[model samples]
Target: MKTERAISDEFMNALVDDQLDSDEKDYALREANQNTEFRERVCELRALKEMVQHAYPQVADAPPRTRGRTSLRLSHLQSLAACFMLLMIGGTSGWLAHDISSPASDNQMVHSLRALQQNDFGIHPSKYVVHVDTANPIRLKTALDEAENLLTTAQDTSQPSQVEIIANGPGLDLLRTGISPFAQRIALMQKKYPGLDFMACGQTIRKLKEQGIVVELLPHTQVTPSALEQIITRRLKQNWAYIKV
Candidate 1:
C-alpha cells in the first residue's frame, strides 16, 4: 500500500508538471477536482514556484562581463549587492506571508481603505426645507410620507434638502407615541438618514406629560419648541424656500 501511494504521488506530480500524456493529464485533473487534498497540494506547489521565482534575481542569457578592476572597493560592492538581495527576499517573504494569511480579511481591509479615501463632500447644496404642520393623525402621516419621498428624490439627484416637521399647538400631539399614526415612520426615517433632523416642540412635550399622556418620542437633540419657532421665523424672515406638506 505504501508503494502504491508513492506511485500515485509520483503520477500526480507528473500530471501537474505536464509530463503525462494528454489523456492521463485529463484523468489526473478530473481526479484532483474531486480530491481537496490533491487540489490544495497542486495550488501550494504553484504558489511556492511563484514565490521562489519572485525572491531570486533572474539571470540574463548573456556571458559574464570581463572587465578591469574598478576604483570602487570590492567589499563595498559586495555589501551593496548583499543588502539589495536581502531586501528583495524580505519584501517577497512578507508579501507571501500576508497573501496566505487571512486573505478574505485582507481583501475586506483593502476595500474599506479605498472607501475611506473616497470623498463625497460638497456634492450638493440644500435647495429647500419642508415643514409639516398638522393636527389630524392621518393627514400628518400622509404629509410625512410625502416629505420623505421628496427628500428621497433630492438625495437621488445628489441635491441636498432639509425637513423640519414642527408639531406645534394641537399638532404637537403627533409627537406623543400613540397619538401620531406616523410615529413609527418618523423613527425609521431618523435611523435611515442621520442628517435628517426631527424636532418636536419642548412646550408640547411638557403639555402632553401634564395631560397624563405617556410620551416616548424622539431624542432631546430633536426636541426644541423655541428652535421650531426660530426656524419658521428664519424661513419667513430670510424668504428661504419652503414647502408645507
Candidate 2:
C-alpha cells in the first residue's frame, strides 16, 4: 500500500532515467500503470526531464550563445515549471499540466490516446495494440478483457479488426508457459480470433536468461526484439489504437 508520496523524487527520477535495477524498475512501472497519481507524477517528471535536456544540450553539441542567454533559458524553463506545478496544485483536471507546459507534438503517446475518440478505432480495418508492462493479476485479466472486448465488438459489427496483446518487463509473465493463469483462455481466444496476436518482449526474455533463468512462452506467442520499439514503430506509427492495460 505504498502511496505516491512515499515514492521520492529521486526514485522517480531514477525510474525515468532507467537507472533502477530490475526489481525497482518493475515496481515503478507497476505503480505508474496502476496508480493515477503516480502516473501523473511520472509523466510530469519525464516531461520536465525532457525540457531540461532540450534547454541545456550537451556541451559538445551546443554552441555558445550571448552573455544573457543562460539566464534567458533558465527563465523560460522556470516559467514552464511554474505553470506545470500550478496546474497540479490547483487541481486543473485531466493532465492539464501536459497541455499547458508542452506542445501537442511533444506530448507523450498516452496524451494522444487520451484525446482520441473512443468510437474512432484508428484506421480501418481497425487495429489495436494492448500494452501490458506489469505482472499484476488484475491488470493481466484486464488486458485480456480489453482485447476480447475489442475483438468481440468488431466481430459483432462485421468490421475487420486486428488486436495484438504485447507484453514486456514483468508483464511477460502473461505469455510465459506454466506461469500465466490465463494460458487456456489465451489459447481459446487465439482459436476464436484469427486477427488476434500475442507478443512477448525478447529483451525481457534475454535479460531473464542472463540472470540464469530459463524463459519460455505459451504456444503461439511471438517475440519482438523490444516491446517499446514494436509498440511505437510498428503499431502506433501505423495508426493502430493503443490500449495500456
Alpha-carbon runs more than 4 Å astray in model 2: 1-125
lDDT of 1: 0.50
lDDT of 1 by residue, 133-189 (tens): 457554477567766776798778877666566554456656666666666777788
Per-model TM-score versus the true fold: 0.41, 0.56
Worst 10-residue lDDT window, candidate 1: 93-102
Clashing pairs in 1: none
Which parts of model 1 are misplaced by more than 4 Å? Answer: 1-127, 209-214, 219-221
RMSD of 1: 29.3
**Residue range 122-220, candidate 2, lDDT tens digits:** 454479898887786767999999999999999999999999999987899999999998999999999999999999988789889978999989999
Clashes of each: 0, 0
lDDT (Cα atoms) of all candidates against the true structure: 0.50, 0.70
Worst 10 residues of 2 by lDDT: 84-93
